[model samples]
Target chain A: MKKRLYIVLFGLAVLIPLGLLSGSPAWGEWDGAYYKKILGFIPKGIQNAKSLNAPLSDYTLGGTNSITGYYLSAFVGIAILFVLFFVLMKIFKARGKSEQSA
Target chain B: MHIPDGYLSPATVVATYAVVAPLWVYGFKKLKASLDEETLPLIGALSAMSFVIMMFNIPIPGGTSGHAVGAALISILFNPWIGFISVSLVLLIQAVVFGDGGISTLAANALSMAFVGSFVGYYSFMMCKKYRAAPFFAGWIALVSSSVLTSIFLGIQPIFWTLDGKPLYFPFGLKVTFVALVGSHMLFFGVVEGIFTALVYSFIKKRQKVVVA
Candidate 1:
């Protein structure tokens, strides 16, 4: 099961660039200008929306090819998830040991 | 649906965070109790799959496109709590790292996509376990259900948070949001989620004597 799951993950990651085929954003997840064009005015909240500066905004590095950035994003995301789980496992194991000892 | 910042009113954000806070606490406890060396790799791989799968944006007939959540497969294989936490983590990464979602609306996004999607998919699979296409139906209905909640969240903003006869937030009514978000999910993304769930579920369970929760 583990091996098969990894295979599936790798296969999907390899095809990650296909996701960029659609230039259209998801419904309701549109730019503020979309509302301006459709409703003749941009909503106040949307216009003044505050968001953090993401390092890899839209999953692309500055000046890099989109496909390369996408592949890097996939692998980086997968690596972070794995490392997170590994750290979680260690914490749980240590807690279990402490509880048993106490 | 990855609701962006400012799509929801402040009141809505506070309300959604209140509703999901306890659920996240309980879900985290459940995850801690279940994580171990034996299951760590499997769960990690599954979560990675969820992240990778979301990258595949399939365009429908309309100009807009959406992707599957992959929560159904995790929900049926383990438990809803595990599925919820796993996907919530994925969403967190997307928001903070990739700017795919919003920080203010994280709780709302997690509630709709992770909590609702996982539980609905899990229960749907359980109910239809006797049938061969149970996973497919579960994934389909789960995604559609999540979209319904998302539509409601986005739809209500215009109705209640408007000023000077102009919507202050999402700027769309229930009718429009329902027709767009829910309608698209029901027609296209839901089908993709169903197929992905069915294929992955069968592959993971094939020729294996593994015990599932």
Candidate 2:
């Protein structure tokens, strides 16, 4: 199961660049400009949205090719998820051990 | 669907967070109980799959695009709560590090794409367990269900929060949101999710049996 799962993950990661083929954003995930163009004004809240400056905003690194940025994002995201689960497992294991000893 | 920050009203944000907080707590407990040495790698891999799968955007005939959530595979393999928590973790990473989603709307996004998607897929699979195509049905219905909830969240903004005839947040009404978001999912992305879930589920199960044999 683990082996097959990783194989699928790797296969999809290899095709990650295909995700960038669509220039159009997902519906309702558009920028403030979209609202301005459609509704003739950007929604007040959206226009003044307190958006965080994400490190890899839209999965792009500054001054890098899009495909490179995408591959890097995939690797980083997968790594982060694996690390997170690994850490959580360790924490849970430690807690279980402590409780058993107690 | 990843609802960006500021797409929802403050009231909606607070309401979604309030509703999801207890679910997160309960789901976390369930996740911890389910996790151990053997299941760790599997769960981790599945969660990573969910994250990476979302990167594969399938553009529909319309201008926009969507992708499969992979919630059904995890939910059917383990349980809905585990699926929920795992996918929620994925969404958190997307929101914080990648900005694919919004921090303020994390609860809303999690509720729709994680909690709703997982539970819906799980129950649907259970109902149709006798059928060979159960995973496909589960994945299709789960994604469509998530899209429905997302449309509702976005659809209600204009009706309630408008100021001087201008929408304060998402401008689309239920009619438009349903037609665009839900319609697209039902037609395009839902099928993609169904195929993905069925293919992966059968592969894993088939390989596991061979290994045991």
lDDT of 1 at B7: 91
DockQ of 1: 0.84
Off by over 4 Å in 2: A97-102, B211-213
Report the error of model 1 at residue A1, Å. 1.2
lDDT of candidate 1 over A28-101, digit per residue (tens): 89997788788888899989999989888899999899999999999889999989989988887888899999
CA shift of B84, model 1, Å: 0.2
Stretches of model 1 off by over 4 angstroms after superposition: A97-102, B209-213
Global lDDT for candidate 2? Answer: 0.93
Best by DockQ: 1
For B58-148, candidate 1 gives per-residue lDDT tens digits of 8888789999999988999888999999999999999999999999999999999999999999999999999999999999999999999
The weakest ten consecutive residues by lDDT in model 2 chain A span: A32-41
TM-score of each: 0.96, 0.97
Clashes of each: 0, 0
| First chain of candidate 2, TM-score | 0.92
